[model samples]
Target chain A: MQKVVKSFGANTVLNALDLDIAKGEIVSLIGPSGSGKSTLLRCINLLEPIDDGEIWFGGIDISVPGYDPNPVRRRIGMVFQSYNLFPHMSVMENICLAPVRVLGRKANDTKAQALALLEQFGLADKAKSYPDQLSGGQQQRVAIVRALTIEPEVLLLDEITSALDPELVGEVLDAVRNLRNTGMTVVLATHEMSFAREISDTVCMLDGGVIIEKGSPESIFTNATNPRTRQFLSRVNSR
Target chain B: MIATVSTLAVAITLIVAIPKMPRWDRVKKSFFNGEVLGETFPKLLDAFVLDIKIFLWSVPIILFIAMLVAVTRNSRSPALFPLRILAVVYVDVMRGVPVLLWIYLIGFGVPGLGLERPWNSPLLWGTVALVLTYATYVSEVFRAGIESVHESQRAAARSLGLSNAQTMRHVVLPQAVRRVIPPLMNDMVSLQKDVALVSLIGPIEILRQAGIDKSKFASFTPYVGAAIIFLAITIPMTRTTDWLLERERRRTSGTRVS
Candidate 1:
């Protein structure tokens, strides 16, 4: 994304923000609430249209006016803070919905793939269960599996663990860690400073809709030079 | 023992007081004359078939119209602004007008417009009027159900590469329809009764037949007979709606044992 601009009436949420992600890289966005981290992620996925900028992905401009985002969205997966599982559907149905309907995959083939993905996530037993029947942690895992079933090139995770209990957060984080091991290109917005420190190839600290500081996690976390970065880190560390 | 004695006392007192009630004989002759009731029951039941037919045919059309109106009203696209306005205007106008008036206007007024043969048919016009009126109310129910779904569900479906229509079909509407079933069913019950309104337009439904019988016999027993037929149909429908709603509640609440 180059110079992406997004505004809500008077409040400019993403102000000419530019970001580039290499294949198989894990980039983490850390910021205070309302700092535009989620907005940036949404813009990348074409969930929000940019006012003035170009987003080049897979050698095409996705932000072009009236561009059909569905095709591009197929290549980008996103997981929300709340596990927005289709409550009316079972886990397997939720997992298979996009694959069979959007991708036009055969139903039986997609069901097999969905079941395999569930087995891989240690949720094989939950295939028949509704979302409300599962724990928050398990539901979040199903959400990840739902996204992965599409085999997206880039995965956007917006505060995926923020709504989970402290104990359940670890399992969701571990799922992200496992995705990183498989070399999926992931960009996540998080408050988990230590997890970002451990997993992110690049940590971008956003403030007021701009990337104020970007570097390796060690430099950004410990030897940060920017005053605002230092202040934000200090406040977070104090907590 | 006390509960049984009190219940018996109430029953005995009501039985003893029945004959002494004011105008009892007149009331019995008017409402419950055996000969009039025997003559009225079958005709009312037979004529009620038309009511059932109207309800059956109008329901699907009403639901389809409601869904379309609700979706149009809920749209956020700038291009759909005109359509949204039209939907809002339609719902407001239809809901504000008395349904009986709609029946009269459509039934009589359309025929006067010198339209085609089908449009001139009072029965068809009556059906259309009922659908238009009831759909306005049902659309609001649909809109409430659709909006009640969390925004995150839309976000999730969109992020999965589903188009807006696809998302609505696979994710949003299924949940919305499930949530709105009880209210929708309640509307259907009201709709069943509203079918009687169409009788004013010359379709010989139960109430119209009862009126004919009352004029012929100079007794109100046929009207009571019509009321019984309406209750017979409506009571089962009401109970079915309640049972379905309770079952849905139990299933979603995870309180179902098996």
Candidate 2:
């Protein structure tokens, strides 16, 4: 994404933001409450139409006028802060829905793959349960599995564990940690500073809708350069 | 002790007061004539078959139209603006008019056009009018259910590459329909009774057949008998809706739509 611009009327959320994510890297976006971290992830997924700029994925500009976002979205999966699992469906159905409907995979084939994915997530026993029946951690894991079933090239996590209980957060974070070993490219907007520092290959601190500074977690967390970065980190660390 | 005494008081008052009325003898002969009731019961039941047939056919059509209108009205795409306007107008106009008037106009007026045999049939026009009116209200129910689903749900499905139609089919409608079942079933109750309205145009349904027997016997007892037939179906339907509603409320402590 180069010079991505997004705004809601007079309030400009992202101002000509440019970000390049590599094939197998994990990038974490850290920012204050009203910053554009979530908006940026939405733009990348083409869930929100960008006001201006170019997003090139797989050698194609997906932001062109009247461009269908569905084809591009299929290759970039996203998980929300709230695990938006379809409550009407069971855990297995939640995971299998996109695989069958969007990917046109056979129902039995998708169910088999979904069961295996549930096993990997340590949620094998939850296959028959509804979302409300599971802990927040388990539901978030099902959400991740739902995203991954589409075989997306890039996975965007928008504060995936923000809604979990303190005790449940670790389990969901561990699921994302396990995904990193598969060499999948992942980007996330998060408030968990320590977790971001632990997993992110690159940390981008956003302020007032632009990347003020971005570097390795070591450089940004400790040896920060920008005054805004220092101020943001101080407030975050004190909390 | 207070509850039991009040209940017995009301029941005793109604039983004693109603029988002592100045015209109780004629009232009984008119509305409660056992001979007229027994004579007309089988024929009224026979004519009710038409009402059931009309109801069976109209229900699916109403549900389909209601679903389509609901989805069209809920669309956010600017390209669908005209269709959305059209849907809004259709719902407003259909809901604004009384169902009885719609039946009378379309039922009696359309056949006046002198179209061919099938098209000229008042049964077809009457059922069409019923569908038009009921679909509007059912669509409103559908819209409430659809909107009751949180916005985050749509965001979730769209993020997973499902198109608008696919999202509605896979994610939204299932939840929406679940939330509105009790209300929709209430509509079914009203519509089952309203199915008898088609008799006003022509074909002799239960209500029409009762009117025929009332004149033939020169008594009102057949109307009571017809009311019984309707109550037989409607009372159970109404009780089921109440039971579903009660269970739903108990399950969630307030029947939370979300």
Candidate 3:
């Protein structure tokens, strides 16, 4: 994606932000709250229309006015912090819904794939369970499964573990680790500093809608860095 | 035991006091006599069937129209601006006007416009007025339901490449409809009673049939019979609404495992 701008009324959440991720690379966006990490992910997914600038994905500039976002959105799956699963639908149905309806795939084929994903995620028994019936970690894992079922070119996760309990966070992070192992390109906004250091190919520290520092985790976390990045890391580490 | 005794005492007191009331004799002749009640019962019951028919047919159509209006009005698309305005106008006008006036305007006044047979039928016009009026109220309930769904659900669905309509149908509306079931049922109960207003337009429904019988027999028994019929249908529905609301509260209040 190119330099993207997004605003809500007077608040400019993303200000001419530019970032690029190559295929099979995992990029983690780390930032303080209101620092535009989530907004950046949303812009990349086209969930939020950019106020200015362009987002080019798969040879198409989706930021143009009147351009259909649905086709591109299908190629870029996103999961939310709140585990926004359809509470009324079962886990299996939730995973199969977009594949069957939006992709126009056969129901049996989609169901088979959904069940396979469920089995792979250790949620095979939960395929018949409603979201409300699942624990927070389980629900977040299901949310990721739902996004992954569409076989997106890039997966964007916005603080997927933010709402999970400390004990539950590991299970959800494990699922993300598995996704990365399959060579899936991923862009994520997160507070999981250690997890990002362990799995991310590159870490970008965003402050006030711009990437203040970008490098390998070892350099950013331990070695010399920009003063703001150091101060931010110290604040997070202290907590 | 005390509650039971208090209830029985109130009932016994009412029974004993009935004969001593100044209008007892006339009340007996007008509302209690077996002959008047028996004579009016079947006819009022028959007319009540008309009320039920109108209610049955109008409710589904009203709900369908109300869903359309609510969805349209909730849209933020600039392209749907005119449609949204029209929906807002329909809800406002229909809700602002009394059902009686609507029945009069549609049933009596519209015929003066030289409309043909179906349009001139009092039954059809009366049904139309009820549909127009109730659709507005039901649409407001539906709008509340739709708005109550969280924004994250929409974002989640849209992120998966579901179109706006698809998201609403699969993710948003099912949850919204479940949340609004009790309120919708409340509107339905009110609709059941409001159908009686259509009687003013000469459709010969329950209350109108009772009026005719009362004038012919010089008795009020037929009105009591009509009241009984309406109670039979509405009381159970009201109870069901309460039961549904209680169930929803319980389900929502249950603690989620962290």
Candidate 4:
């Protein structure tokens, strides 16, 4: 992604920004509130249309006007801060919805795949349960599974654990950790400092719609150069 | 209990006070004469069958058209702006015009065009008018449901690569329609009563039959009989609406979260 811009009315949420992601890399975006982390991820998933610049995923420039976004959106999945599960559906139904309805996959095969995934994630028993029947952690994990079922090339998680209870946060992050072990290309905006430090190969500190610093987690967390970076880290560390 | 005594007191007061009025005899002869009520009641009942027929035919058409208009107005696609505008116009105009005026315009206007056979039948045009007008009101009910669905649901579905139509069908409408069932039935009850509006144009329905009986017997008892028949159907429907609303409230309160 290069020189991407996004504005809502007069408020420019994402100024001219540039970034790149490598295959099989976990990139974590850490920022204060209103620092454009969520907007950046939403732009990558084409959920929010960028006002200017190029978003090249694989080889296609998806940010071009009139470019069909559905094709690109299909290859990049997103999990939101809110679980956003279809409350009317069972966990199994929510997982299989996109595959059957959008991708036109056969129901039996998809269900079998979904059951396998659920088994792997320790949610097999919850398949028949609706979202409201589960804890917040379980719901967010189901949301991740729903995104992953489509086999997207990249997973964009926008503050996925922000809504979880403190005790429940670890369970949801455990699922993301499992994705990292599989070498999934994941980009996430999160407030989980320790988890991001542990899992991310590249950590970018953003402020005011741009990444002010980007480096190995060891360098960024331990040997920060920017004063804003140091200030931000201290504020978070003190919390 | 105090409740029973109050009810008895009010009833007794009405009984005593009503007969003491100077014109009570004349009013009783006009509106409550048992002999006249007995004579006209059967004719009103027979004509009410026409009203029932109109209600039955109009219900499905109204629901289907309302769903279409609601969905049209709900769409965000720029390409569908024309259709969205037209839906707005339909909801505005149809709701703005009184249902009786619609019956006059369609029931009388269309047949005057010299369209042949069943096309010109007042029965058909009046039903059409009722369907068109009531659909707008019902469509607003559906729109309330559709909008009540959070924007996050759309974001979730679209983020999963579902197209707008697919998301609406597989995700949004199912939830929206579930939320709106109570309101939808409320509109149905209102439509059931409003079906009597067709009588003004031609159909010889309950209200029209009451008019006929009023002249024949030179008394007003048939109108009361007509009111009784309408209340008979509407009262049960109103209770059912209340029951549905309570059940929906319980289901959603227990299970649904943001």
Candidate 5:
């Protein structure tokens, strides 16, 4: 999202935010609550409309006013803070739902791929279990695989582990770390600074709906240029 | 009056206690003899036939009209608010009035208005009245079910590359229907009972047959017999409703377990 502006009535959540994520980079967005990190992620998939901006995914100008977003959204998979797995569907069905319905893939083909994804996430045993039957971390991991089953080019993670218990957070982050190894492009909105510094190729600090600082993980962690970034990091690291 | 009540009590007790009572056998013999009593059996059968005809014809038509009303009420188009208000008014008016009045109004009043001539057949008039009155109620039931699905589900579906209609058909409706099945079943049971109101229009339903037999015999046995048949049908339905409610509770609790 570049020069994107989104306001609810008069309160601007994203103002002239400019960002360019590379083809296969894991970029972590860190900020205090209500800093528009979530809104920025929402705009990339056009879940939330940007008042004035350009979002270019691959070669597609997704921000073209009045353009249909269904095709664009199909290529951009998003994981939510709440996991958002369909409770009525089993883990395997949740993974296969989009592929069979939207993509019109054969049932056998979708099932095979869904099972493989479940196995890859170490959730093969939970194929028949519904979302509510799984732990918070397990549900989040399944949610990630659910998005990936559609073969999206960009995966948006909106604080995917924030809703999990502290003990369960590691399992979800580990699943994400495994995805990072595959070189999938990821834009993560997160609060776990250690995980962010460890896995992210680049980190962007946002405050009051604008990017206040941006750099490599090492630079941002050890020597933040902005006083706000330093103070934010200090408080985060202390906890 | 006291003597009549005492006689009814003794007859009921004998019928209840003695499964093979000769008095019941005598009534059965008279019914099979193809005389006045014989007419009761065929009349009851005809009533059942009429009930089936009403259900088969009316349910689909009601469902189609209800679908249109539900979709209009839920959609965000320019006509949404007016459509919603119209549906609400329809439900309120139809539900508030007795079904019998609506039946009379549609059967007698519509043809008097110089609209298309009313259906000449009593069966047709009854079916039409049932469909018109129940469609409004069922439409509201459908609307409530559709609205019960969480808004977040819609958002999630939209983000998953589904169009607005697709989201409604696939994600929203399935979940909503699951949630509202018990209430919907209750409405259907009530509709089945309401079929008896067709007797008011001179169609020979079970109650009408019972009434004719009662007037001819000058006895209350036909009324008791009809009550027994109605109970036989509805008791199982009531049991099914209990089972459905329990199943839903279990499913919801299971979902919240983790």
Candidate 6:
């Protein structure tokens, strides 16, 4: 996303924010609540459209207005803070829905792929269970697999651990870290500064809908150039 | 007093003898040979056939109109408020008045306006009345189902590159309709029962046939017999509906345990 600007009525949420994430990089967006971290991530998948900017993903310039985004979206998968699993479907069905619907794969083929993904997440036993039958962490993992089942090139995580209990956050983070290790390009918006520092190659600190600092985790965490970044990181870490 | 005594005596005899009588060729032959019973079955069958024909024609029209009304009522346009008011008024008026009155109004009053051939048909009038009344009720059911779907579900579907219509058809509506199955089935049962009211317009529906048979026979057995047949059909349907509702509830509740 380059030169992205978005506003809700008079209050702007993102202001000319320029971000470039390379393939196979894990970039963590860190900021206070309402500082446009989530909004920026949402704009990447066009969940929230940018008022002004260019979003270039997989050689498709989504920045252009009126572009057919379905093909682009097929390569970008998003997981929400609430873990929006289809409650009516079983875990395997949740993962297989988009694959069969959007990709038009046969049911047997999709199920085989879905089962493999579930087993990789150690959730093979939960394949037939509905989402509500799983714990928050398990549901988030299923949500991740649901996105990955479509084989998206880039995965967006929006405060995925914010909704989990503290004890369950580790399992979800672990699953995400595994994805990062497997060479999936990941863009995550999070309040977990420590986890961000550990898992992210690049960390960007945002405030008032603008990026105050962007650098390697070691540079941003240990030697942040901006005072606002220092203050925000202190408050986030203290929490 | 004599009439009452005769009615009670006939009821008691039928109740006692119908089931207790030994199965024999003589009794079967007598039943088949009886003029009253012979006439009653054909009339009853004709009425049943007419009832089915009316319902089949009306349900689809009513469902389409009902779905349109429901969507308009939920739309965000400036016209939505007036549409909501209109829908509410429609539902209230149709639900408040007896369906018999609507049938009479449409069947008798509409023809006086000098409409053409198809509109003048009794079957058309009766079906129009049924559809108009039932559509109002079904629209409310559809509205409730659509609203029960979470807002996040719509957002999630949109995020997945689905358009509003696609989201409604694929993601939101499937879940919403599943949630409202019990209510929908209840409406269908009510629709079946309401078909009996069409007989007031001189249609030869089941209740009307039963009434004609009672008048001609100078006996009430055929009327009671028709009642028994209605019970036989509706009881199993109602039980099946109950079973489906219970199973759905169990499935949803069981999923919430973890």
Top-TM-score candidate index: 3
TM-score, structure 1 vs. true? 0.92
Q: Name model 1 segments beyond 4 Å from true.
A: B1-25, B113-119, B253-258
Clashing pairs in 2: none
lDDT of 2 at B236: 90
What is the C-alpha lDDT profile of model 2 across A1-239, one tens digit per residue? 89989999999999999888898899999999879999999888888899998988888899897889998889999999888998878888899888889999999999999999999888899888878777777888899999999989899999987887887677766877878888889999999998899889999999888898999999999999999999999998998
Residue-level lDDT tens digits of model 3 in B1-258: 999999999999999998999999988888876898898899999999988999999999999999999999988789999999999999999999888899988878777788888777877887888898999999999999999999999999999999999998998899899889988988898899889898887789999999999999998999888888999999998898788777765553436345
In order, the TM-score of chain B in each prediction is 0.90, 0.90, 0.87, 0.88, 0.74, 0.75
lDDT of 5 by residue, B170-214 (tens): 788877767777777777778777888878877787888888887
Name the lDDT of candidate 1: 0.91
Per-candidate TM vs. native? 0.92, 0.92, 0.93, 0.92, 0.84, 0.78
Clashing pairs in 1: none
- Candidate 4: residue A232 Cα off by (Å): 0.5
Error of 1 at B155 (Å): 1.1
Local distance difference test scores for all models:
0.91, 0.91, 0.88, 0.89, 0.81, 0.81
Q: Which stretches of candidate 2 lie above 4 Å from their native place?
A: B1-13, B20-25, B241-258
DockQ of candidate model 4: 0.59
Question: Following a full C-alpha superposition, what root-mean-square deviation does model 6 have from the true structure?
Answer: 8.4
Q: Is the docking of candidate 3 incorrect, acceptable, medium or high quality?
A: medium
Candidate 4 C-alpha lDDT tens digits along A1-239? 89889999999888888889999899999989999999999888888888998999889899888788888888889999998999888899999999998788999999999999888767999998888778788888899889999988899999987887887677767777888777789999999898789878999999988889999999999999999999999999999
Give the per-residue lDDT digits (tens) of candidate 6, residues B18-74.
Answer: 867677455555334356665687678767878777877888898898888887777
Off by over 4 Å in 4: B1-29, B248-258
Return the TM-scores of chain A for each candidate in numbered order: 0.96, 0.96, 0.96, 0.96, 0.96, 0.95
Count of backbone clashes, every candidate in sequence: 0, 0, 0, 0, 0, 0
